[model samples]
Target: MPLTLPSFHSMQHQQDFFCLSPSDSTMTENDFFKIRPYHNTKKQMPVLAKSRRGMRPMRSSTTSTASQKNRKLRYYSTLPVSKPAITMNHSFHQQGPKKDFISLLPYEVASQIVSYLDLSSLCQASTVSRSWYSISRSNEIWRHLASRWSLNIPQHIYPHQLDWYHLYKQRHILNNRWENGRVATHYLMGHIDSVYCLQFDKQKIITGSRDRTIKFWDLSTYQCVQTLYGHEGSVLCLSYNDHIMVSGSSDTTLIVWNMKTLQPIMRLRGHSAGVLDVCFDDRFIISCSKDKTIRIWDINNGRLLRTIFAHQGPVNAIQLQGNKLVSASGDALIKMWDIMTGECLHKYAGHTRGLACVRYDGTKIVSGSNDKTIKVWDAESGYCLMSCEGHTDLVRTLSFDKDRIVSASYDQSIRVWDIKTGACLLNFQSGHTSWVFDVHFDSTRIVSASQDQRVLVMDFTTGLDTQFL
Candidate 1:
């Protein structure tokens, strides 16, 4: 039998009597009767616990405190608490919203996707939203995109105009402006026309020009060593053996020059019209002429060995790779000839316009044409491997390196392109102010000649370099 506290019914009667009494300790067990009853909404209200001091005060819900006053202060100190756990019923009623589709992608990943699109598509995609706008504005992305569209941009874009046609003029330092450049000692000039062709040995530069002359320049002094004069008209084409220089003149003659003395060794004449192009490998000199025939000559004796009459129109260019001779003609055909027997091995006819020039870089024969395109052909089979088209004007001349092919056009620009992918690597336009008549590359540098009456040299030792003819 536990002793029971005063009943609430008995305490209610005392509270009415207590209202007339005002003494501090005058109230009996009915003192608490005036207080309101607890409610569920007031779960944090003060609670009383039985103790030695009769009815003790409330304590905070922590183990650190004992006094009610200290506990009350501690509760107020922690004004903010972790959120209560969500009830199962509430969680089941709601689901998280799906993220925006674009927001799910990373910025680099978006840019990579944009890169796969063409220029027109890229421009449109950039305007789709602000995030895409940011990706489009990146210089790396735009620069790469520009390169893919056209190889004419400077390798490093500047704040100024970086278009392809204007790049050469801005970059090339003329003889009058050589002092303003970094390496002034390394430069050359000689031809009245742009130096269309260049061949380098250990010590000299042998150049041919539309001015109908071949010049030997001393590399150390950058001065004309000797001028070999024999061709009656513009020396439109040139080739070299280890010891001799062969030039094809528009005057319908091919002259072989002694490399050491720069003297005309032999003036071989057979074509009725201008001999537009010439080439030589180990044993023979091959020439193409406006006379509409391809002639193979013995280099040692300067004698015509075999003549192949394959093209109906003028043979504008010739290239010899091993025993095969490839010729591009004004008839819009490329004919492959057997060098040993002078037989027509194969004929490639696809150009709607005349082919202007051809070059053999051991592995392939690259040709340019009035059709405004360059075609790479298999030297062995005469199969057309690839055709590169972009020039607005006739592509007049072509040359190749191990990894790249270069073209000169009547459009007055020289374009460097990757051989395998047909991607453009660089565009040079500064040195020529008129139609670029011809272009060629030695093992180390690129050279171009133009009707502008000036030759231009691009030195590989410097970063994107050029010098006047």
Candidate 2:
């Protein structure tokens, strides 16, 4: 059967059916071919393919292409031209001014069609013409991509702002550098004794050391801005939030300092032994000690809240997640506790020797042990997921973000591992000359403390975009 074309006696109605404007009433067969729905073609083409208005119909070079084009022209030849003055019996078509395919469609409809393109294809399409360029850089296109990574972008979520696309570009380049182990290393060296524990945010780094004091370092300058003297013994652990910073000491005392003023507010001396680890959320200060106990303290006045003779041996580390607490101990076990009810929610046992450090994100738990191995555990079922083995001595401290884990050990080495696969990503054995005591990281850098009395910073953010980080 011959292909039947819609009668164009009424051009106004026929134009709507083809998604065309009034000016296209005199369109030619070539225009009709361009307007045809490309059934087999993908919405996104190869980034290298050049086109016009980003809506140029893809041309196929297959054996069937000759027949397809012939069929399209044949179909167009039979359709009547919608001319107001021309007679219906005219034999050949009389074409008017030619119109490009993109201009012929409603802009919103055209934009929706091109939104399927990935960033690379969109960029290539922008060079085709002004209309394609406008659509390619539109805020809507970039915003959709931003939402895929996360919707919490810092600024310019509204249209007409171009930072969303810029952020997307920066993150990809930074990730590639991290996977390739490309980074710069900086050192901080003022502690009189070994650096023991550390934490940092965007502006500054806070570290506790065996020097019997806690020090604050400016992140940008990498210099010690201030040092506070309160602990009579080595400061072993620390934790802080927006309002207060707390440091625990081998003096068996914990001191709370006002974050804004950096002045000591209260000192609670109750633990009979050295405080080994400390952590807190918004409401409670939780600390574990060498006395084989975990104590919860009121964050405001240093009031003793509750105590759980937490483990069978010295508690090595503790982390707080909302109302739940997880503690690792020398008894070679990890226990999750309900903060309010004081009930043991679960227990994880796998390491052959005692645990030295642990970190969790509520779903997954990563623990380092004297057994010389790191274990990843399913937080829900207490089952071991993967055992990462590389350290030659006791794994002393560990930390993790969403993508990878950074661990330090008595072997005088630091190792980075993929959080999901347990494969070692990077190893740095020369940064410290003694046991590494603490480790932490953010999106752009890894910070570690060691018994060598020095802090090493492996920074991957140089010359890369880390605005979102």
Candidate 3:
């Protein structure tokens, strides 16, 4: 070079005379620039010199502090980013895991689901948990299930308090017992003559016999406890509710008795001929007689209310529901009447021969005829819905529900038929040795009384023809 210049890196620990004093530490390039410049210090600067080879570099205290600060910054820069903190007050934190979907479903949806299950499956589900038990034991659920089998809880009983599962089981077992021909038979042999009509409740079996007396027998012991003697002729028919017993007699009178005391309350004498059948409710008493007339009586005062000349022949059977009454007559006609106004509303006339027995379920009129056929009629329209033909002889007594009709015939057989289709489902002949006089049924078993002086109870649970023998 033409002029000698001081080298910036060649001087060690040099300070300008006119500038502020530096700290007792190595100076950085940035720190050196921050000092005030001195113009007169050029001459004091060290002369330019050639650098020696392999010389060690000078260290500064500021380098370590700066490096420490830089290291901290670099360490922070390499760390992963953090998300926002979630508070414990969130719903997810409070509820933990989600609840079961079925348990969370609405009650209506749950009940509909439970309704689809059969009795066995529903019983099994009741043991799953408390929630399931509550749903399974609901009265609506059990009521629907009971309805499927045509089992109705009595109107006086509370469905919620009843054990539906046990009730169903008992019915099933009783039906099985009937199918297998295993029965607990009680002879009930107090009557001196044939028992013409019988009725029972939970406590007693009341029978009206040709012996001209009404006998009250204990259901459990099968022992006749009391005999009500008033009718001069044979007792032909009997009907009872919880508090009162009404009996029709060949003496041409109908007697109302106190069911508890077995004492006569009133003796209604208006029928010119023997009273064939009698039915009553809380308000009125109805009687059909061999005189071909239907009479309505005031239950309280024993006063005759109205009378209708219903048929040309004797009225053999009668049933009362609400304000209407249905009477089957030996005239081969079935008439539905308004008891209050003494008017015939509908007349069902299809049987070729006189009807022997009849039953009305408020909608359909079922009549068994001496024509050896059972006719089902529409009570409102007077149309013959179906004619069930199977009995070789006259069909005498029968009972029906929503599905099937169980009939007892003078042919000494009990037959089951589909109510809708009129197809014979099962024929039971071996059980009765003589004409089956009267038959009654619930949801499970058929109890039939026969002219053989025997009562046959048959199970309908299996509904198998092979079991009917």
Candidate 4:
């Protein structure tokens, strides 16, 4: 028969008698041990096999065996242990202290090592020791972590009182909320027609609409702060900086405005067809048009510097960096041009249909096409590196930074993508009720314009400070 555990009372009574009267020399080793019941309430006592010595002779203080001459059994026993608990005490008295070499390293080296740890691991490490706490909470380490994540955390913020880890924690929360769609959605409602173009910074949002008026909005209050009327037809595109603003319109004209006073600086006229897009920097204002031409103009005056026959069809979008210009055209081609000499450097072609928007950051080019795919191109080799596909309709507008591509589509959706992996990280479809025309984002929020006649701001940093942008 299989061995079974007896009741606590019965087993104790039998074990007390067995230990006191046991001297069976002929008993097998298995017969020498007795299964005794103990008082632990977590589980029933188990049947343990015997040892070779009689009654499994244990050290005892209160009792002894009469027949076995001091051989004893622990009737009210505890669990067995080969070692004592004193050896495993948390004081670690038996083991020497381990030197924390990582914590003793120079600040730069320590920061680099801790940077490999994710936020959770870093937080846990901070509590491990005083030396680690000091190393993990260093401002330099937290600042590096923020930059490594490619977040737009503000620099020179409260130089004396700044806490980089706290700043990163808040920004990380905002970024996580963005991926999870936990944003506060608000609309800038002053535009009477479809909002077609938009750009923003820390202070305000500038939007152009089919109503032929450009409205400037205070981002904090979501209220229109100013309006400018200079275009006869619908405003199509615009770009601006701290000092200057340039806008393009279906009237076949480009206007330069003094951003300080929000007044017209000059009117530019060159394209035969409607001007589609405009961008400017410290030196030049670049514009593209339905006339299939790219025009370079003086930033201070309305004088046209040079015009290049850019593509076979309407140049739908154009972006400028240092001395190069990248234009996406209705002919399903993307071309890079020299702003100084008006020369075509290279042409990139992969889209099966016309291209709608393009962004160039000197080293790479990203373009959205009517074929519903976004392609990343190597600026130096004219090679298509990766293609991101998700939108079911024309990928009309897109903006990107070092990490993410925020693209809006005629499918009435805005998709956020990982720039390096081509992963579609977020798909926001409820913000707009009609075709989305433009989408832009910083680290905190995604602002988009749509044909629904409203400009939506999805603020991922709803309850957090946006001082960093």
By lDDT, the best candidate is 4
Task: Report lDDT per candidate.
Answer: 0.65, 0.78, 0.73, 0.79
Q: Where does candidate 4 clash, by residue pair?
A: none
Best-first order by TM-score:
2, 4, 3, 1
Q: Model 3 segments beyond 4 Å from truth?
A: 1-168, 171-186, 454-469
Q: Report the alpha-carbon TM-score of model 4 versus the true structure.
A: 0.74
- Compose the digit string of candidate 3's lDDT tens values, residues 1-469: 0111111222133342223223223333224213243333122523334555796554443233456666666765666668444333232222355465656788779988988886556655555555666676666776665554545446777667776644543454444443333433345667776567776654567778777988877755768788899999988888998788999999999989887777889999999999999999989999999999999999998999988999999999999999999999999999989888888898888899999899998999899999999999889989999999889998888878887788888898888788999988767777666787777776545667666755554433332222112
The runs of at least 3 residues in candidate 1 whose Cα sits more than 4 Å from the true structure, single-residue gaps closed, are 1-188, 193-196, 380-382, 463-469
Give the per-residue lDDT digits (tens) of candidate 2, residues 150-200.
433456554455565556545654565566666677889999899999999
Q: Which segments of candidate 2 are over 4 A away from where they belong?
A: 1-111, 119-134, 155-162
Candidate 4 at residue 78, lDDT?
41
468: Cα error in model 3, Å: 26
Sorted on lDDT, best first, the list reads 4, 2, 3, 1
For model 1, residues 323-409, the per-residue Cα lDDT tens digits are 877888888988777889888887887788999888876668888889898888887677888888777789988888666788889
As a whole number from 0 to 100, the lDDT of residue 75 in candidate 2 is 67
Looking at model 3, residue 9 earns an lDDT score of 23
The global Cα lDDT (0 to 1) of model 4 is: 0.79
Total clashing pairs in model 3: 1
Worst 10 residues of 3 by lDDT: 1-10
* lDDT measured at residue 288 in model 1 versus the true structure, 0 to 100: 79
